[model samples]
Target: MSTLPTLICLHGGFHGPGYWGPLVSLLADKGFRSITPHLLFGGTDKPIQSLEPVIEQVAKLVAEETSKGKDVVMINHSFGSFAGCSAIKGFTSKDPSKLSDQNSGKALGIITISGFFPEHEVSLAAMAAASRTARGAPDPATAPQLPFKPTEEGLLEYDGDPVHSFYNDLPLQEAQKWAAELENMSQFVFATGGGVYAGWMDVPVWYLLCEADNMMELPQQQSYVKKARDSGGDVTTREIDAGHSPMLSRPVEVAKFVQEAVASFSR
Candidate 1:
């Protein structure tokens, strides 16, 4: 009997594991076992301030699941995609040959939903700078000013209107509820790069582009998709008419595509 792949979900900035609740529940009904880990940056109880530790944590989780003889399909949203890709890179680098061997460190594929695709050694800060430059805006020395303010400890807190930036398609009450549950995130995570290994090149990658995303503009998303495809990534793309937080606005459709990705691996 073929073992079904495990879906490992990583949420975006200011979001904990709870952010994946809707999609996880839907995937569960379809017989998919999904694990949503609260990243160190967004932990309600304890938040870590660095990116390396977060990547290590994710890699450790993947290793633990693969050691149990289960294939992993990493699903990432927004900034979480950077951590997910970094984790995959770390896992594959430990045993490059095992990437093709399903029994050892089994990583089936990666699904990036409205996520950033950073180039090798390119930090998120740099990507943000480039985005601003593309729009003919002045480049700032520090991290780009966000809609939210950072606390005295340098943790980012979302203070902007979620309805406009994230859950534009979601109901007002539902969007407000989720927005209120968001936690503080470490600024370090966004400033760091994916390092040497470009994991997307080695694994099958599916990019879900949210066409109506306000946070990540449509053109910016397309640029990332192009970068992945041009760099020899086995890329597949599907565009949805939704905002940045599709899990809140279109959970069923998001889960359907994720299920399709898992099915492709088995075939």
Candidate 2:
């Protein structure tokens, strides 16, 4: 079997796996394999009340591939990175001599696109609230009211225009098409804090920092990279003049970066 590490693409909140279609096809054309799973937190099912399901689902997918003797590279975008980091525990730093016959593959690397890297026990919601308050928006507890709207069904949807927040670089028609597909994610997702296991602390990491991201401003993204670095993480960052959804607006660029990350496992 060709032993190229599989690419596991994890989409952000409010997005479905379909959003990865363009990038997946591009990677496929280059002889790379990818799996894009729909995280239940972002699904239309009953609202997900905890982060464990998202983490468990991703961990299950990785375990399946690794069991097949195929190493995996996680490509985590936006809120997807939160689950990815927590889910990657125990999958890194494999010892071949101690490997079980059923599972030998290891995690090759992690790639985060405008990812959110919260401290241990810190929820994404708290981080956003603090960030907003620092910028003179509102009290830390009330800052969430500006950017997200709680649906009657208890889910959270982007309050502002998605085109402005997520797809400012795409053409108007394309942007609108994707905007209409946005779903209401579980409000509890941002409330869940990170676990003790954050794979970025141990695995090789590449961060695609979107310079023009309206949703996650460049400074905030830079701060994440810096935080990870300060904690002794091995992170390589590439700045792109694109919006938040580069996989949709700049597929070729995103594909090239993913390819670069996959190639690093060999070097």
Candidate 3:
């Protein structure tokens, strides 16, 4: 039997690796192995003053897998997409359009679910600011801020109700249970774009656009997809009628989509 590339699952801010349990189990049942790293920026137990640690952790995991002759497919959600870029730098499959010396790394492709895409040298904060301006923020002082509130110890907490923000498609009881698992993420995460490299330009990219997502609205998600495609990145998108946490509300569909990517990689 041909070996499937290992799945490297990266979770978003305010979430731990446990959040990927449902999707991971489903993929495992289909004979695909997965690795979900517990990124430190999302942990409330420690202070994460920068994105360097998160990037280093993911890069180390990818390096280890490639060292063992195991190709990987990176799957990231929400803020995890930004970090994923830096981690897969030297490991991505070469882009035909971009001339580069990195041609032998074992990463086959990338998948982003309701994820952010950063332009080269443009920070997430800068992107957000540009978005605010495009929407005609009449006054900088009166414009709406990011959906996070300052918590103790320089951590940033989600300002919206978790149920409505992430798990609207899930049952009330189940949504509340998952919501409670969220943590106060590092404030430094969104402060800079240190981890935002254009790795997507180096590989085939699949984007799962959550139409019902409250956190990342559909327009914003579509805009990112368009931007990526215009920049000569090989990006394809699949629209799903689910909330931000599709892995919980629609694990079967998510699994099937991932399997589709795996099948394509084998070709």
lDDT of each: 0.79, 0.83, 0.82
The sequence of per-residue lDDT tens digits that candidate 1 reaches over residues 1-267 is 346788999998878788688898998888888989878877544445567777788888888877777778999899887778878764553345534345564777889998877667667888778877877886477655677776777777787776688888888998888877778887667777644246677678888999999988888889888877887788899999999988878899999999888888556
> Hey, what RMSD does candidate 3 come out at?
3.0
The segments of candidate 2 whose C-alpha lies over 4 angstroms from its true place after superposition are 94-103, 129-145, 194-196
Clashes found in each candidate (C-alpha, N, C closer than 3 A): 0, 0, 0
Ranking, TM-score, top scorer first: 3, 2, 1
The TM-score measured for candidate 1 stands at 0.88
TM-score of each: 0.88, 0.91, 0.91
lDDT of 3 by residue, 95-169 (tens): 322213333337788889999776665667888889778877777688656678887778888887999998999
> Where is model 2 poorest over a 10-residue stretch in terms of lDDT?
94-103
Candidate RMSDs in order: 3.1, 2.8, 3.0
- The best-first sequence of candidates by lDDT reads 2, 3, 1
Candidate 2: residue 219 Cα off by (Å): 1.0
Pick by lDDT: 1 or 2, better one: 2
Pairs of residues at least 3 apart in sequence or in different chains that clash in candidate 3: none
